[model samples]
Target: LNMANMDGDETFESTLLGEAEEVFVERIADDECILIRGTKNHSSASIVLRGPNEYFLDEMERSVHDSLCVVKRVMESKKVVPGGGAVEAALSIYLESFATSISSREQLAIAEFAKSLLIIPKTLATNAAKDATDLVAKLRAYHNSSQTKKEHTHLKWVGLDLHEGVVRDSVKAGVLEPAISKIKSLKFATEAAITILRIDDLIKLEPQKEDKKYGGCMDEE
Candidate 1:
C-alpha cells in the first residue's frame, strides 16, 4: 500500500519519502517526528493538522478525537442501534407498557421516565423547524403500532429524518450510533437524577432557616 497516497484525502494532505534507502530513526529536540519501531502488522499512523488560528486547530483536534473515540467504542461493542431518536422512542413505548403493569407508586416514576425519553425526538423535531408536538406524537404512534404486528417491525426504526423532513426507518437511512454509548448515557442520566433526588430528600429532612435569620437581622437594622 502507498502510505503517502493513503493519507491524502479531501481534508488532509501528506508527503512521505518514496526511496527504499535505509535511514537512521533518531529523536531530536524541538522536532515533531517520533520514531516508532514495530512489526508490519503493528504499525501506527500520525495525523497532521493546521489551521488559521489556535482556536480553530483546538476545535479540529477535539472533533477528530471524538470521532476516533466513537470508532473505538463501536469496535469494542460490535453493536449499534438506529439513530435519529428511534431507539429512544421505542424504549419510551416499551417502558410505558411496563408502567401499566405496575400497581405501586413506582408506576408513576416509570411512566414519567418513559415520557422523558420522548424529549429526544421532540428536540430533533423542534430543531428542524417542524412541529415538535405533532412529530413526536406521530413517532410515538409508529413505535406503538409496531408492537401489534410482526410484519410492521420496521416501524420500530421509524424516526424523524430532519434532513429529509420525513419519518422513516433510520437504520435503512444509514443513521446509526454505538449501542454502548447510548447505554452509558442513559445509565449516567439515571444515576444523576437519583443523586439529585437524594439531595432533595436530605434537604427536606433538615430544612434550613438561613434566609429567615438574615431577614430578621435586616428588619431590625
Candidate 2:
C-alpha cells in the first residue's frame, strides 16, 4: 500500500499501510530467495536470511521474530515507558520519596527496596562499560531536582543516556516500552520476591529403603 488514506470527504489526512498475502521460498541461481505476494489491502515483503552456517540463519529467524513481536506490542499498547532505564529510575525516585513519608522502621525497608530498584539502571550502565555509580548519582540528582521543581509533571521521560553518560529525555530518543507490559512485569516481580521472602519452610526429604516384599507373610507363617 502506497496511497494516501482518504475519508468519505476525500481529505487525505493519513497514509495507507502495507500488508502481506503470501511468501514463497525458492532457489535462484544456486542462491536462496523469497517471493512475496501483496494483498489487496496492501503490500508484502520477503526476507531471506543468509549466513555461513545453518544455525546462524535459525538464530537470525528467532531474532527477527522477537523484534517483530516487540514492534507489534509497542504498536498495540501505544503506552510507552522509557526503554533506557527511565521507568525504573523514575520508580526508584518515587519509592525513595515514599519511604521518607513513613516514620516506622518499615521506612528503612522501603528505602532499601528503593535502593534495590536503582540496581536495574546501575547494572545497565555497568554492562555498557560506563561508570555505574556516577550515572546513578546523576540520575538521582536529576530526579530530585525534577521532583522539587515538578519538572517531571511536564517532562516525565528522563533517563540516563548511557551512550553519552548524561540524563536526557528518553521519549524524544524514541526509547520506549509497552506501559502495560512494563507495569505488569514490575508488579509480578515484586509479588514473586515477597512470596519468596515470606517462605520459612525447609522441609528436606530423605531417601527411604524399600519394604521387605515377604516380611508380613513370614510373620504370619
Candidate 3:
C-alpha cells in the first residue's frame, strides 16, 4: 500500500524514503480492518434501530394515572358537611338554577333530588340550635317567678338562673376582651379571603412604582 498519502504531508514521497517508509507501511499493515468495519457497522445499526418507541408513551400513561389518582383522593377526602343552613339553602337555589340548564331532563331531576338531600341536615342543625336557645330562656323565666312556688321549684329555678348567668357572663367576657385581638384575627381572616379572591386580580393589575422620583422605563430612552 502507498504510505505517502496516509502521512498528512503530500510533499513527502514515500518511494524516496528508506527505513522510515518501511516502518510506516508496517504499522498500517498491523491495524485490523475487520475490527474497524465491525465498529462502524454496529454504530450505524444502533442509529437505525430506534429502540423502545413506547417508553415516552408509558411514562405519560403513568403520569396521567397518578394525576387521576390524586384527583380521586382529593374528591374522596372532602368531608366538610356545609355548616350554615342559610349557606346550604343559597347553594341549593343556585344549584337548582344550574340543573335547569342541563340538556338531559333526567339529570336535572337527579340534581334537584341531590340538592334536596343536602338541605335537610343543614335545616335540622339550625332548628336544633334555635329550640335549645328558646327552651333555656323559658326555663330561666319560670324559675324567676315569685308566686306560690314550692321550695324545690324555687331552688331548681335558682340553679337554672345561675347556669344561664354563667353562660351569659362567659359570652360577654369573650366579646369584651381586647378589641385589638379580635381586630387582628379579623384582619388575618379578611386578608386571607381577599388574597384568595384577588389572585387573578393581581395577574390583571399593572405594576405600580412607589417612587416616580427615581425615574422609570419611560426615562430609559
Candidate 4:
C-alpha cells in the first residue's frame, strides 16, 4: 500500500511503493488465523501471533506495537539499552549514588525516588510468578551492592531475568529496549508522583448547627 503523506524527495519514505499482490488469507484449525502479504516492488514482512484468549491476543498486539515504536525511536536516536528492567536498575544505582552527594533533606526524597525505580523489575518478577523480593535483592547485588562492587563495578547491563526469576545479564539474553523510552517513562512518572504527593486540601462541614434543639422545636411547632 502507498503511504498517503510524504515529501517527494524524502530518503526513507516508502510512499509510492506498488500495491501488494498474491495476498491470501487462510484459517487453520484450533482457532488460528494467518495472512500472507506479497508486495510488488519491495520486501514484505509478516508476523504470526497465536494466543488462546482475547486478553492474550490484545496484549500481544500491544507488545508488537510497543516494539515497533521502540524501533522507530531507536532509529531516530541510534541508542538502545538493555531491557528486562536492566536500564532501570542501572538508573536506580546511579540515582542512589547521586542522592548521597546531596546534603539536604532532599537527599531522603531523592533516595526514596531512586528506590521507586526498582518497581519495574519488581513488577516484572511478580508478573512472572516469581518472588519479587528475592529477585530485587539479587538485582541490587548484581548491579550495586558491595563485595561484588569490584567485580560488577562496570557491569551495569545486569537485569532481572523474569522468566528465570534471577538477576542476570540482560544484554546477552536478547533483552534490549529503546533507551529513550525508559528515560522518558521515568521522568514522567517521577514528575507525576511528586505532583500528586504535594496535594494538600481539606473540607469541613458546619458542625450540625443546633441539630437537637432545632429539630425538637420544629416537631413541637
Candidate 5:
C-alpha cells in the first residue's frame, strides 16, 4: 500500500489504480457486475486465473534466461587469470621472516629483521603467535655459541638473506649454487648477530647476561 521511489525522491507519486486504469478498461468487458472499493491512493488487489499464472511464469523464466546470458557474455569478454599462488608464496616468505625476527633472542639480528619486514604491506603479511615462537626457537638453536661454531656460518648468511634480501656480492655473483654453499658455512651466535646487524644498523640487541652472585672473601688483616 506504501509506494516511494528507490532513490527517496518525493516528486514521483502516482497511485497504482491511476496507472492501471487504461489496462483494466481494455481487458475487462463487464463493468456493472464488479464492485470496486477504495480510493486511488488506497489499497487494491487483482486475482489472476490459471492461464494468467502460466503466462507470468513464462515471463519470469525468460527474464532469468536473459540475465544469465548477459552475465556469461560479460565474463567471456574479459579473460582473467587468478594469480593467487604468486601472492601466497610472496606473503609466506615475508611472514616467515617476520616471525623469525620477532622471536629471535639476538637483539641486533631481530631488530634488523623486523625493520626490513615492516616495509611489506600488512595485507600481504601473517601475524601468528605460534609461528613467531617457533622462529625464535629455530634461531636460538641454529645460532647457539655453545654449538660447533664453524658449521653455522653458512646458516647465519642464509638467515641474513632471508631477513633482508641481502647477501655478499660473492654469493650473488656465484648465483644460487655458490650462495647455498656460503649459507651452509654460517654458525655461531656472533656471526648471526653480526649478519642481522649488518642488514639493519638499528638492531643493537645484546645477548642474555648470566646472573652472577657475589661471594665475599674475608680480607686478611
Candidate 6:
C-alpha cells in the first residue's frame, strides 16, 4: 500500500507477509517521519526533543533521565512510599518516641535526630510560601493521631499539600515516591553529616591585611 504522503515518483511495494487486525500510518509534517501503530508489543522506540537553545535541550535531557530513573526504580523495587515529606514526618515521630525509652545520654542525640527529620517538611512548607511552623504543627498532630489509632486501617499518610497550602494525606493526594530512593537519600545524607562531624581537623583562612602606606610608606598628594 502507498501512503498518502508518498510522492508520485516514490513507490512502496510489499507482499502480504502476514495478517493483522488493524494498522495505522501517518506522515509527520515536512520531516516525512512515518508513525506506525496497532502493534501488540513495542520492543523499541525513539525520543525526539526539540528546543530553540542548547540550555533548554540540556534541561530536557536531564528531565528525561530523571524520569527514566524513577521508572527503573519502581520497576526494580516494586514499592513506593508517600511523598510530600509524609515519610519523614512519620519517621520523626517514631524516633521521638524511641528517644523517650532511652534513659542514657545518647537519648539527646536521638532526640536531635528526630527533630532533624522535620527539616524535610519544613523546607517543603517554606518553599511553598506557607506558614512552616503552623503546617508542621498540624502535620505532627495528624501523624500523632494516626499513631494513636487502634486499627491499622486508621493509619494515615499525612503530608503537606503545597497546592492547597495545608496538610493532607499524601497517598490520597497521589503524592508518592520510590521507597528505595527515599531510603538511599536518608542513608547518604546521614553518612555525610556523620563524616563531617567525625573530622577533627579544621582549616581556616586568615584575612589579608591592608597596606598602611602605598609602596614603601609613600603618601599620596
- For each candidate in the order shown, give its overall lDDT on alpha carbons: 0.82, 0.77, 0.40, 0.77, 0.39, 0.82
Candidate 6 residues 62-89, lDDT tens each? Answer: 9999999998998899999998888888
> Candidate 1: global Cα-lDDT?
0.82
Compared with the true structure, what per-residue lDDT tens digits does model 1 show for residues 1-221? Answer: 44344467534234432333233555444355645544344345557777888799899999999989988999999999988889899999999999999999999999999999988889888888988888788888899999778888868888788886778888888888999999999999999998888774333466556667576355654
Clash count in backbone of candidate 6: 0
List where candidate 3 sits over 4 angstroms from the true fold.
1-82, 121-221
Expressed as tens digits, the lDDT of each residue in 1-221 for candidate 4 is: 55344665425446744676566657754554555456665565766778888799899999999888878999987888888777777777888999999999999988998898888888898889999898887777777753247765656777877766777777788788877876788789978998888889767778655667576356644
**Tens-digit lDDT string for candidate 5 (1-221):** 34446776555444332532323223443332344444355465644323256688678777777766645644654432112112222333444455665645665544554444323222222232123333433443443421346754443322212333322222333222222222233234346766665784454679856545524444457
- List candidate 1 stretches off by more than 4 Å: 1-42, 200-221
Deviating ranges (above 4 Å) for candidate 4:
1-40, 43-60, 145-151, 204-221
**Better-scoring candidate (lDDT), 2 or 3:** 2
Whichever of 1 and 3 has more TM-score, that candidate is: 1
Clashes of each: 0, 0, 0, 0, 11, 0
**Residue by residue across 1-221, what tens digits does model 2's lDDT show?**
44334543433433554455877887965677677676665434456677878898799999999888878877888876777777777778888889989999999988888888887888989988999988888777767677768645634567878888777888888777788778878899899989999999999999865558964344553
The candidate maximizing TM-score is: 6
Arrange candidates by TM-score, descending.
6, 1, 2, 4, 3, 5
TM-score of each: 0.71, 0.71, 0.19, 0.66, 0.16, 0.75
- Candidate 1 vs candidate 5: the TM-score winner is 1
Q: Higher-TM-score candidate among 4 and 6?
A: 6
lDDT: worst 10-residue window of model 1: 12-21
State residue 56's C-alpha deviation in candidate 2, in Å.
2.6
